[model samples]
Target chain A: MTPNERLSINQATIKYAPLREALRVTADAGITSIGLWRDSVEAASLPEAARLLADSGLRFSSLCRGGFFTVPEGRARRAAMDDNRRAIEETAQLAAAGAAGSAAVLVMVAGGIPQGSKDLAGARAMVQDALGELAADAQAAGVTLALEPLHPMYASDRAVISTLKQALDLASPFSSSVVGVVVDTFHVWWDPELFEQVARAGAEGRIASYQVCDWKTPLAADVLLSRHYPGDGVIDFAAITHAVKAAGYAGDIEVELFNQDIWDTPSADAIARTIEGFEANVALHLGSLSGDARP
Target chain B: MTPNERLSINQATIKYAPLREALRVTADAGITSIGLWRDSVEAASLPEAARLLADSGLRFSSLCRGGFFTVPEGRARRAAMDDNRRAIEETAQLAAAGAAGSAAVLVMVAGGIPQGSKDLAGARAMVQDALGELAADAQAAGVTLALEPLHPMYASDRAVISTLKQALDLASPFSSSVVGVVVDTFHVWWDPELFEQVARAGAEGRIASYQVCDWKTPLAADVLLSRHYPGDGVIDFAAITHAVKAAGYAGDIEVELFNQDIWDTPSADAIARTIEGFEANVALHLGSLSGDARP
Candidate 1:
């Protein structure tokens, strides 16, 4: 595979760079695929961001996020759904010029339990309600809502969907063509059932995005920013990446690091190391497809 | 249910205080049961600590913990297993004078992946091997090994077993009377299959310990010390406590907070809030327990 065929740098890994600069640096790195974040798309006018990606000759792999459906109603919940709908529209515009990229996959990071509420079940139900409200619209816009189950550490404060099984369960009501799940190494490498779940996800044809990032030891005080590039931590990426590949996943793998220390580095340097780490710790596993990872 | 009948303070909750002082504070606060830690018992001299609990009339709920079987090697592995046997001996001595506490329940925290390794499956296998080595001895010494599945966030550096299902699976090969699993609210509260697992554990007669500790939002810098008292966090304690009750788990609920902020506070005040939180968030579910809850 060409570098562009397999590697995509998620904008969050070089968050300090402006949308145009991020796209430019990623493209300049000889990587021809990129993932955009909703914030970055909005920061530049959506039309201009679309024009930039169109002109840069990069396949827009996926969008960073569009789900925070964990707030209670009145305005906050409505506002969040409305924002997500708008994100879907933005994703549609960017993918209009799709090449090998079929369409922009909009990742959904389900928000945590609502504030002043401990009803985890209620919060999860709300996520489903929001998805039901938006699923048809997503199909209309040609944007797939990819549910991303974050680490359980983020369960209370970020996403209640803390496993691939839960994400698929939530997505089961919708057609796989419109809704799917993300298989990100950072969120799921610790799972004892990782191989089975990956295979299950593959069989269901519901893997919408494949994201890679390493979990750094001595985690940052703000654990959100503790993710390093692939090889920097203890995750056995060759095993996880191989699991995804064995599961019939042939899509672009996005490198989405969230380290504050890495963010402080120049975007060029960061993107360079991301590519290096991906090649060394992650991409090496892409060569073979039939091997089953051990439990 | 009487306050003393269901509630017990784990020594690690007030780890700042001496073992004798923690027990004194517990007894002074009208609590008649407590869980001891190996460090606390060692600090006070095991015989003296046992004498204190026996004299104070506090029913020992369970021992704090005794499992770090992830270390690799002949001497290192043997050393860890030996230490665990000694812990069983200590537990047996403390429980000889029992009132509603037939045998000492030892909470086993299977250690994380060993240094220079990323083999999670191997670490878990090693844990099973160690349990096999100790199960007979634990049974002989009148000790029940309770495997605690910590939150997934602790999977890399603290424990490899990160789910109730995995813990139950590991304990399956052994007799329930010799091995069991801990249902810690702080750890397993985020799981999607929590209720199902709780019921499975109960049906299998493996709910050895029901631990109560809240997962504090905006977790402390040291993730280890981020546990709050019951009502102080977002976990729906009523839901979890009720599930454990419905699952036929009749066991002492140990409050095992590890917050640094609370640790800095006077032990008496911490113990007071624990009881208050227990009554408010956790014990309300205890009112209709079908006469189930052991000391």
Candidate 2:
């Protein structure tokens, strides 16, 4: 029943599960780690959710998200910033409640262009400004703000940050531990500069979280749900995994799928499939475990 | 009925139009130029298509396509190269038979990663090899091999070349006139490096064509047909059009809509809408026509 030591199941892969059920199913599947979504954590009340995670003994890999800071200056923008501050505190607390290897990393999706706006550069600038405002809070809370670059297809309404190089550039001004980047395979597999950016991110000490999922096209009617289990798509997992490993990203690899079909499967079945996919497609290229996993 | 002198209707915008109808509809709409698709041209017989275009007194903007060179070296690969050679010859003849401002440019869409293979880098290298093999023939035939960078969404199944920088790098190995690039707004409007790369393409003297279309969400079930008319979506045409103009490109600006709804419209009605969209969204930013249009 032992899964790959570095495997972490992002809760979104099992969308319908309540926080306690998600933790129990992941633990019972022999998976030692989980990435929590803010909705489930909030729904259960953070204190109770934290207790459930502690009892499950699953290491906390990362928080599902915290950055939608593309709003223009106003009450809405202020509210978004305040929410992010709360997320940082939640990330810190969740990591404290999990097993020894838990990472206090909050994945950030710099939101799409502010509604009714076509100023992409301006939206991106807002992200940088938001980071400047939030970095000190994140640092104080000991939470890493991990910026994720979504695929370009979602650039207008979901995320304007669309390349690893762009994400790295945005993170350049802050300390690596305070502000870093997420290398999600689903979002960045198409980037021409991926390997080079992976190396550059490593050199700059900005690789905060590494998430994996496969990309098969004829994307879902909702392009957001187009992710698949690894080894199920055309993505070259071996080449990308080798690059990430070479770049010294020695941490839990989270599988965060958004596909409706995968979400419909039972939570334990989904986790089992994720383990099989990771072991067959990604774990083989990861070399040895590097002593980073907690029992 | 006088359209912007620089405006051109790419034949695929009206996918069902035969060569004669496409030419007649475009000229009747007062559009001075048209980009022809190879299939329609072949349908009319290249010679007859050229005669129809010349009779319509429309300038030849460019040929619809020429490259799909991601196959492994074998009979299929050899067949693809031969087909590209024929495309070059057709481009030369069509440009020769058109009005004075005709451009002998053959748009090249580098094929996707070969089926069942995940070697993206290898597929890209094959594009380079294909271009090298055909550059001499293109140069001799006076055809500009316009390497087009489709959106990253199409990287796995349509075109491996998904960025202007990548296309430019591939074209750098040959003369700018022999190997050039297409600046299709629908494909590249999301690129973070777009403006910088547009300036680079201009500086390199490698911009062979400039195509415009818009992007909106709730993309079609078939993503290939997701393109919209210029003003129909969120792209900042003023900014991008200005960038292209500032890059010193004075060629015909082609409006190539691939949306199913647009294709379903009567051809003349579609061209009419394209003119309106371009005039409102792109033309104003284009500044004064640079004496490049023919009467």
- Per TM-score, the best of the predicted structures is 2
lDDT of 1 by residue, A1-295 (tens): 2353589989999998998899889888899788888888888889889888888888888887899998877788889988999989988888775446645699999998887888899899989999999998999987899999999999999999999999999999999978999999999989888888998999998998899998867778888988988888889887888778877888889999888888999999998888888888877778766665645
Question: How well is each residue in B1-295 modelled by candidate 1, as lDDT tens digits?
Answer: 2464689889888888887798789988988888888888898888898888888788898886799899886898888989999999888887775355534899999998998887888898999999999999998987899999999999988899999999999999999989999999999999998888998998999999999988867888888888998888898888788778888787789999888888888999998888988988887788886643221
Model 2, span B1-295: residue lDDT tens: 5789999999999999888889989999999999999999999898998899899999999998999999999999999999999999999999999999999999999999998998899999999999889989998999999999999999999999999999999999899989999999999988989998999999999999999999998788899999999888888888888888878899999999888898889999999999999999988887754432210
What is the docking quality class of candidate 1? medium
C-alpha lDDT of residue A139 in model 2:
95
Model 2 Cα RMSD, Å? 3.5
In model 2, what are the clashing residue pairs, if there are any? Answer: none
Error of 2 at A228 (Å): 0.6
Model 2 stretches astray by more than 4 angstroms: A288-295, B288-295
**DockQ values for all predictions?**
0.59, 0.54
